[model samples]
Target: MRFLVIFLLIAKIYADDHELHSKHHIYKELSHLDLTKEQQHRVKKILKIYRKELKEYKELEEDIEDKRKDIFLQKSFDLEKINSLNQQLDREAHGIENRFLQKMHFVLTPQQRKKFVHYFDDWEVE
Candidate 1:
């Protein structure tokens, strides 16, 4: 029983590691970049800022969902409010992504920047 428990624990740990290293696509790409200590620190800082924005986005998502529900359930439908909420969602999404990408590019060196661009096929430095 002891041996079985130990084996299961090790397997679980390995599974978690694989999930983090393999399943997290961005982290896997970042590991390939070979960042220096300062570069890593700067990248972490950039990610921190991104996380804050992401939190806001999550909250905004909840609000949007509630707004959608409230709109649909109302006795009188309001198309204008729905349109306004959609526009706000679009603007926030674009702003968060553009801001994060720019700051991330700024922290990386020229070579790292090239790698980042290459790794993220959709994103260009220009």
Candidate 2:
């Protein structure tokens, strides 16, 4: 069950990363919404912070990747360590993503939120 949860979380992260190739991809999506200047500024700020958080997390990701490689390469398999790393990555990734989403949800108007939510069919930010 725990492994399944970890698998799902990893899959979700991969899907999200695939969809969001760049911050500009999000900006392009928002362009269709007709956001006001202030809303645009707030969204941009939110994205900037999100990017910074992701950048900081990258080092941790690399460390985890190295650990994963070691686990696979070593004679002894470390299921426990792999699970721990998965949980940590899941928690941090979700934390960063949720913070960005919460900020975006708060910044947009109800109508804008509706449009944005619908535009990305998977996002249930409401």
Which candidate has the highest TM-score of all? 2
**Each candidate structure's count of clashing pairs:** 0, 0
Alpha-carbon error at 84 in model 2, in Å? 0.3
**Residue 54 lDDT (model 1):** 59
Candidate 2: 10-residue stretch with minimal lDDT? 6-15
> lDDT for model 1, on a 0 to 1 scale?
0.63
lDDT of 1 by residue, 9-28 (tens): 32333344443432343344
Clashing pairs in 1: none
TM-score of 2: 0.69
Model 2 lDDT, residue 109, Cα: 85
| Pairs in clash, predicted candidate 2 | none
- Candidate 2 Cα misplacement greater than 4 A, ranges: 1-27, 119-126
